[model samples]
Target: MTDIIDLRSSLANRVQRWLAGSLDQMSDEELLKLVEAQSPAETIAELLVATPTRRAADDDWTDLLLRGAEAKNQIARLAGGLLSSSQAAEVLRISVPGVKQRLERGKLLAVPLPGGQRGFPALQFQRDGHVRKGIAEVAKAGAHLDPWALLAILVDGGAEGGTLLERLDDEAVLRDVLSRLAGYGEHAAA
Candidate 1:
């Protein structure tokens, strides 16, 4: 454990030096643009060590942390059941472009995977190799929402009295639940 801790410390110091060198090489405008493009995880990690700015209150930092944790948890859950686009295409016996088209048309659901690629949940397909019924309708209804949010509704239980995954076979129940979720999304957007 001591050796592990020492190794981690050494790695962290190296990273800190690397980041410092990189930041020093960037123009102010470039630095701002790079910061703007950072993912929530990267932003959160930076904020943990960053000096509090005059524009941001302590409460604002806390809120950012909470939001970051939520995003992290969502991503972890997504990765747990995720299939790469290629894997999904293979499973569906469709071309990669076809898989992407399905996602774009809301015929299938997907979320942005960690490395800037999309990941489709395995639950979206049936054992018989068909897209699960009622999912497209749900996806269409929740089209305004983030794909990750739609995925959370489907996988996480107790929102509409139970998990949507188990109710996918029941068109009526699934649609009803999805409708309610879509309404929530719409309201939130409003």
Candidate 2:
């Protein structure tokens, strides 16, 4: 009886793993069909694991987590914490000119990508270690300087302070950023 129960348990686990979602090892079309057939929760679970590469699975999982985080973030944004250029400057702990310099140098993450992209989601500056620049901080820290400058300085890093900016310029960075952003969009629409 114990042997039979153990066999059943093993069988159930296999089925759950198989039914969880489409395997990444499959072709794109096959994977899409599997994903499309599954419910969102199932899809999320499958994406959490069951991929060929654990590394790839981790990468994908990070993406999904980011999406969920961004959703929570959207609610936060609606509650009114967005800062303007000068306001953001104060948040970053930098001069307004420095903020302007970063913007002019195309270092800042702009809401709308170049080429006049229409109605895209705003990039979450909060996630890039800019949470300290929130309204609460602005209230506490005094609003004279941009708080986001603090975040910018931190993200910029290194002796020169533009490495993060350069990394953001990479095509892969844009794709990953846009992908995570798009994931949030899907959840919002649902």
Candidate 3:
């Protein structure tokens, strides 16, 4: 338990360091707006809105760091259910490069791991050594969204019913689910 606590503290410290410069640049009003946002995505959207012009050189690093931190938080919340790329590759009976290529092609979804690695959710693969049916479609659908946001959609059920991940066996249902998630993303962006 103490080790877990220490790990959490260490992770938090690293995230704080990554975010420090961007947070430091925010005005009081922007900071207050971020505080008022309901979720991390909303907070990040608010921050981006406040500094649209900050996409220049140095600030680009801040944006990447923020995204990486969000991915790390999402994976951490999964409680070790995610596998490292090497583990995923072994499970899939493929090389690490193949696993990475699948991720790059949006055939598999992954969250950013701490230390600049990527973690694939174990739930996406069956115990029999096969990728869940329709998962590729869902991943392709969510390719434009942040990895954390995509994971949320997969894990949390929408108004229609079960989670996207849970419905992967039904291709038609998965399509509907993916459409609903895409709508949510559009609405959020607007």
Candidate 4:
């Protein structure tokens, strides 16, 4: 995401600094490969910051570092947390059956519920720092609905013109949304 710079030299420099007294008497290439694997950019940044301990390397350390950093960033972004089948469905507002179908399709995870009670874990739906909440509103209403519908709506970025996510605080509206999303679980897996 930034200008390309030499990585191996940077890494070598960093290892020299971070592990100042403890750096193994290893080859520059060996150290570069290790740094390249973990976080080239971070390593390079470290080296740049720790200019007090610079070292010479074979060739273009900047290119190697940039490639390594790019790779690390992509891999980090692809990783996601796991969720129980029920929790996945509840958060997505799909039926338990629908959630299972998606799981079968490799669309979501199916972590086991606590005590093996066969319910979804709430933690599965959290993204970043925000999480879905206020399902009690639906419970309070006369209608009984599945939690997935609300979650799915929320995850979908709140639908076209409007969605339940925006009105989660409005007990009445949320209840209605939940009612509509519920009852699709007649054939859902337990």
Candidate 5:
């Protein structure tokens, strides 16, 4: 993370550009708190209300927007990589509808993008433009989990020093990863 004062000063400078008034009038702590909880969308909300879109004290519309941004960020981080449907189709040498069908059938993991678009996890695919063998089997076995959770487990380089993707080709290795996935499901259910 960055130094708080510098971050606050930088953001205040950006927001100050939107209005002629100086944002420095705000105390250091107040300025930090205002910008800290907010994302870019929250800044947009602030700008909108700065003009004429004020609402009641309790009617904060920015909350959901902030949550949406956070969720998107988390998804991208957990998946480690993503590709648009078209990109995935091109990489897999399949049609767009085929990509969608694979996603629906749990043969592929998708990162949910904003505006209802979904992207495939790029790490799940090999350099040969094919999905790693046995990945779909583990994904299907872990269908009880969310995409982010499954991706996290798949991408984690365990004590073995490589991702589960590397060893998933072996029968025992695939079964071991599947057992770990089952453990995750049991834990999640509990």
Candidate 6:
């Protein structure tokens, strides 16, 4: 009887994981739409981190958990947007060594690539052949965070609850995101 129960449990877990994986295969646009329709990243994060004053409804809890998973998947999507060091150097009109110096100075962000190399995020570059200054500010301010965490905060955070990258041109959103990045952006008071 116990063996039968254990077999059933294992099967159930596998089925659940398969379902989640299937849902995670949505296009980035579709995933963002679903996540926004249910809850913004900030709200989901706040709820996950904050101690509850009362019992949340079961549906609410389930939705919150699922939204958190969706956010993780979104971060994974951003991984494909990474640029090789040489590629980044070309984009910014700088030498590869210059790019490395910026990384050491917290003026740029990079994620670990296979074989122990770094890949800069392409999202930070602008149309005029310059990198976004705000990314450097956020990196410098949020120096306490790991590179991947910093990337998530940059691409996913905004005051109005839209993806920060979507409003890269908005002065208000830029201020709000910087102020909110580490509970304080670069311009925030100590």
Ranked candidates, highest lDDT first? 3, 1, 5, 6, 4, 2
**How far in Å is the alpha carbon of 138 misplaced in model 5?**
1.4
**Runs of candidate 1 exceeding 4 Å displacement:** 1-80, 159-162, 185-190
Off by over 4 Å in 6: 1-73, 157-162, 184-190
- Residue 31 accuracy (lDDT) in model 4: 56
Give me the displacement of residue 129 in model 6, in angstroms.
Answer: 1.7
Candidate 6 lDDT over residue span 1-190, tens digit each: 2223544655566546544554455466655555565456654454333323423235464556456545544664663366778988998899999999988987877876546778777777776758775776777777766666766867775457656754656787778767766574445455
Residue pairs with backbone overlap in model 1: none
Cα lDDT of candidate 1 equals 0.68
The candidate that wins on lDDT is: 3
In the order shown, the candidates' Cα RMSDs to the true structure are: 11.5, 19.0, 12.9, 15.6, 10.6, 16.9
How would you order the candidates by TM-score, starting with the best? Answer: 1, 5, 3, 6, 2, 4
TM-score, model 1 to reference: 0.59
lDDT of each: 0.68, 0.42, 0.74, 0.45, 0.67, 0.64
Model 5 residue pairs with clashes: none
Q: What is candidate 1's lDDT per residue for 10-82, written digit by digit as tens?
A: 5566557555655665567656755875596866455444423323224455456456546645653543467
Kindly give the stretch of ten consecutive residues in candidate 6 with the minimal lDDT sum: 48-57
Tens-place lDDT per residue, model 5, 108-133, is 87755546788677767888988888
lDDT of 2: 0.42
- Estimate, for each residue in 1-190, the C-alpha lDDT of model 4 and write its tens digit: 1212334556666555545432354457645654775576776554454343545342356446656565533332222323455556666767778866644453332323235433333333445423345543433331233333333433333444444544556676666566655544545744
Per-residue lDDT of candidate 2, residues 1-190 (tens digit): 2223544655565546544433535567656655675588776565545454434324455456455445434432332333456665666667877766665553453232123321111223444535222223222222222323322322333344433323444455445433433354356568
TM-score (C-alpha) between model 6 and the true structure: 0.52
